[model samples]
Target: MSYEEILLETEEKMEKAATVFSDELKGIRTGRATPGLIENIRADYYGSPTPLKQMASISVPEPRMLVVKPFDVSVIKSIEKAILKSDLGMTPNSDGKILRLQVPALSEERRKQIVNQVKDLAEKAKISIRNIRRDSNRQADQLEKKSEISEDDCKSLKDEIQELTKKFEDKVNEYFDKKQKEILEK
Candidate 1:
């Protein structure tokens, strides 16, 4: 592949890694209620497992309360079961038509655990970014060996890849820090 293509692919992969990390961070509880925490839960809609967000309308009527009204009220029980099966510790209070989830305040110990989880996720994202850089560097070297690019060009490509890696790693760190502060302070 051309140098431009290699660089663009590397950058896209790094961006995807960062985006996934950000999405995961949204699921971590921050002593507040948010639709994101439960939107991805898989509920049995008919014979298929569907995301809760698609099966229902999840809203935060209050800072600490989530109201989930299923588009098909018949699926309320399945949604409740899904919520219970989720890793989230909260239980849903269900009526015949809708469900209410009470977002409890995070205890100090729980907050610490969540922060640690964030750290782990951030590390994983950095690792992904590094892997993409390695692949891009290898491709550049191959291009150099084939005489498709000069030695200096390969070196420049590797340097550019390294810079992209650093930029993405910093972005992941920034997301982690912001999440950590939110979890600990709230």
Candidate 2:
């Protein structure tokens, strides 16, 4: 509606892009076990697809192992089946009630592939942030044309939006670098 509103919207979207990138990076496999990898998986629960976190309690008893204890023992088989079918590539060792997944070490090639994927994701986030900046700048121009905002106000708003974009882009780059290090660590 106004230049200030446009800037706020742009800032909000930039932050959202950063948050999304961070969440996705958590799912990338590394050298250790973490709840983020499988917590969002959709497992068949009585003909309905449910998030694994809701169906089971996941814990990392060791650095390389994940113990998944289902709230309903009857769902253990379903959970196992889901994990087997998923791209996690880890075998599920089920013992009637609880399931264990042994997270394996990533090969050098796999680590490189994952790093490339992270780079791609980071690029996409940056592009999205840039697009938001463009749209906000365009809106500011429109407000100036309509005399709702002075040219000086529009210029200031665009500058603020650009700063927000740079801040979020840096955040995305920071996430990429951190994840890359985690994936490559021995």
Report the Cα RMSD per candidate. Answer: 0.8, 0.8
Q: What does candidate 1's lDDT look like per residue over 1-186, in tens digits?
A: 999999999999999999999999988889889999999999999999999999999999999999999999999999999999997888999889999999989899999999999999999999999999988999999999999999999999999999999999999999999999989986
Q: Which residue runs does candidate 1 get wrong by more than 4 Å?
A: none
Q: What TM-score do all the candidates reach, one by one?
A: 0.98, 0.97
- Give the lowest summed-lDDT range of ten residues in model 1: 86-95
lDDT of 2 by residue, 1-186 (tens): 976678778888999999999999988899889999898888999899999999999999999999999999998989998888889999999899899999999999999998999999999999999998998888889999999999889889988998999999999999999999999997
- Model 1, CA-based lDDT: 0.94
**Clash count, candidate 1:** 0
Clashes of each: 0, 0
Name every residue pair that clashes in candidate 1: none
